[model samples]
Target: MAASFTTSWRCAFLALLALFVSGAYGQLSPTFYASTCPNLTTIVRDAMVTALNPAVGGERRMGASLLRLHFHDCFVEGCDGSVLLDNVPANGSTPAFFGEKNAFGNINSVRGFEVIDTIKAAVEQACPGVVSCADILTLAARDGTFLLGGPTWAVPLGRRDSTTASMDLANRDLPPPFANLVTNPPDGSDLIARFQRKGLSATEMTVLSGAHTIGSAQCQNYRLRLYNENRIDFQFAQGLKANCPQNGPAGDTFLAPLDSTGSTFDNKYYTDLTGLRGLLHSDQVLYPQNNQTQAKIVLKYKGDNTAFFADFAAAMIKMGNLSPLTGTAGQIRTNCRLVNPA
Candidate 1:
């Protein structure tokens, strides 16, 4: 009798563990919309191709912006499309509220909204309220990167959109380019911690940072590093100083390539860090002056593009899996910019 009771208890425990894991992490699928919206991938790709416009340097600019939007959307309150909300100005118009658009990490930084809107409209024409805005954003990021000559990955879908947006959480959770780490010389442990909380590892954090390889940074974002930091490359710093003056002559609108090959997706960003040519302070922190962990990861990617591409695609899937709202938990918004009205 005692042996039978112990066997029953063990089986019950394992069953419960399986249920928890499956319900929590196994909710998304690569073919989630196969029957519901059969043309979802093709639709998103066509929309992205038009919006990205590779013929005129548009793909280079929009690819990074779309990726940034997806990251911003996922990190705050899951990948439920909350980061796309727009609130009314607090000028006695309607009930006043702040949207994630004006959040600290976002504000004038995150773009590709018009492109997302265009994609959403095209998706709606095909499937009409069947596909969710959250899924569209995820697919857009993947397709945008693919069109720009980067590694392609299957984006798991079936995420729902959040009716509410959170500016406060966005400001608090999203890692900035100037966050301090837990180490003496800033080895990027803080950034790692933030990603870790969302189920990402330090190695994955380094892989995602490679997105910087194809984007342009505004003068405002890197001016602090150019003026104050001593670890940046000397000639690179001098060239930046010429465009972005010490005071207010150029202000903050000037643009600088994030990597040597800003228009193409490659391992050059990692090589840039190896030479102390990293643009953002948070970026430089990964391979700090005297670092061990992140520095070695940088060198590995700098040496091998195939390894970098594989790891980056895997990391993106992991990042996309963070805290999704599925199974009737959230609404499918008609317009990504506003919550659907009752």
Candidate 2:
């Protein structure tokens, strides 16, 4: 018995060919944290950096390294955008600066919404209504946390943005770089103080300093802590004599290669912090005393960089969601820059 060629077989073959071609041109839906959600992981991640860049004093905060600062601060609870939004009224100094201990202000920190706006503007051109601005903030923050040696826990997509920056709430939400600020006793925990508040121990703080492995900083941002000659506890080594001035009102480019791998992200920031070469005093404070645990973490990383990086990732996951407004409480920005967009 012989089999005959049938029209049905030909039709089936043609259909198979068509399916293959379609799949080749158009991929299957992306895999988001949620099954029904399409893959917007990349969209959210890229959008976050874009939004984060312009917020840190524009050109000043564009570096990938500093974004970790945003991640570390926010991840203590949720992505509250408190670190970025200081325009709203606060109990003391609404505009807080990261490097300026004397005049602490949060002026240039970029919020998730800003990143959402820029990313949306770009993603809109690519895929309209396929992604959410809220997710981008979280993804970028998580990725940032990861880069800074923090955990990379998965966050769900479809998060909404807030309509307003919470100044009253912001102060409560975000920890200042220097707490208990005073001339004597250096009362507050520097960066370690805030890190502790976020549930990370001193060891985590020391290891997290590895984030400075590849970022740029405002000379003024690190100057007070690095070029200290005024008996401010934060003092610079004589090796930095040529770059930073021994006077006031400094400029950028005062320091170079803060870590051995200043161009790449790694645990070198921890090593530098141990040597008192940390750019920010907050970074240096995680050593020898109240932050003994953090100091141990740094020493451990000094011997084993891998362990430091691992701890950093865990801490980052914890940091990104610190006091974040999710579910229904916050507004999802169509554009991250202008509030609600006119």
Candidate 3:
């Protein structure tokens, strides 16, 4: 009887252990790397600080770039570090493939790859193969936002690196700066639909749009708005037109801040929206006169900085959780730009 009872207890314990491992494989946790890579967060934060230091040629604008990188990565293919992959040449067994780097939305935009490479090198030095590039990108975004005067949140880790990337998906999934401009009076429906397709709610979309408070837009992106749009502030349009030419690609690459305070991450984006001074057509559409629901949320965020920060942090956490490749689903790439050789 004693032997039989011990066997049953052992069986039950093993069952529970299996269940835990399976759950951990699928779900993300804040302390996922507590024992393996204890200094992971510090390593990423230090690298971001160095990257943003102007003395070394780093720009505070890189903070926005880093955040944008993470968002772009997550939206297409579930935050699997696919955006970091370079275009692969066609070998006998493998087919030629292009990556997100040259996609319509990312070609001239979506930079900061060098900063990520630096952080990956530092992480590799400390923990070697234990950490994944996907998690590093996510954490880097969080650290960048915080370093740029944005709210910080606990990032759930355990994401693995993807083996492949999709340029087609990147083009399709990423929201464009000129989205929803066709209607006589622009609306947030298109932007809302794009975010909803990614499992983000409309409110989450509005709050996430606040990320534009930092960074700058290129002339080509906003020239149409400047030349023809009537909703834009007169002075603001004139200021942008001075840098962006009326025709041709001469000043296409010229940049203008997305907001008055483009270097700082703040609620001023909502303020710009309320005054019809939003840099992108998609931005101004959020607070359109017809969309009272979105307008109310924008006003709420504009008035209460604390509330915006809190909601922005929460929304970011939710966005990070989208379709992550957790557990044994993917491999951890030694180089973020290339998949490990099979």
* Cα misplacement distance, residue 54 of candidate 2 (Å): 17
lDDT of 2 by residue, 1-342 (tens): 122344344335444543443233232111333444344566656544444444653432234433543553354335543333223323365553232111234444332334445656666666654444545554665565544344344443443445544444345534444332122455344454455666766555555556667655555555566555332233445545456665745544454555556555566676676666765555555554564554576678877755555555544434444455545566645454334534
**lDDT-sorted candidate list, best first:** 3, 1, 2
Q: Show how many residue pairs clash in every candidate, following the order shown.
A: 0, 39, 0
Better of 2 and 3 by TM-score: 3
lDDT of 3 by residue, 1-342 (tens): 996886565445444543443354476777789999999999999999988889988899999998999999998978899999888899999798899887888997889888889999999999999888989998988888889898777677888988988888888888898887234454433677778888788789999999999999898888888888899899888888888999968899998999888899999999998888999888888888777877899999999887787778777777877788876888999999999999
| 2 or 3, greater by lDDT | 3
Candidate 1 off by > 4 Å: 1-24, 54-59, 89-94, 181-189
- Name the weakest run of 10 consecutive residues (lDDT summed) in model 3: 13-22
Off by over 4 Å in 3: 1-25, 181-189
Pairs clashing within candidate 1:
none
Best prediction by lDDT: 3
TM-score of candidate 2 relative to the true fold? 0.64
Q: How accurate is candidate 1 locally (lDDT)?
A: 0.82
Backbone clash total, candidate 2? 39
RMSD (Cα, Å) for all candidates, in order, is 8.8, 13.3, 9.9
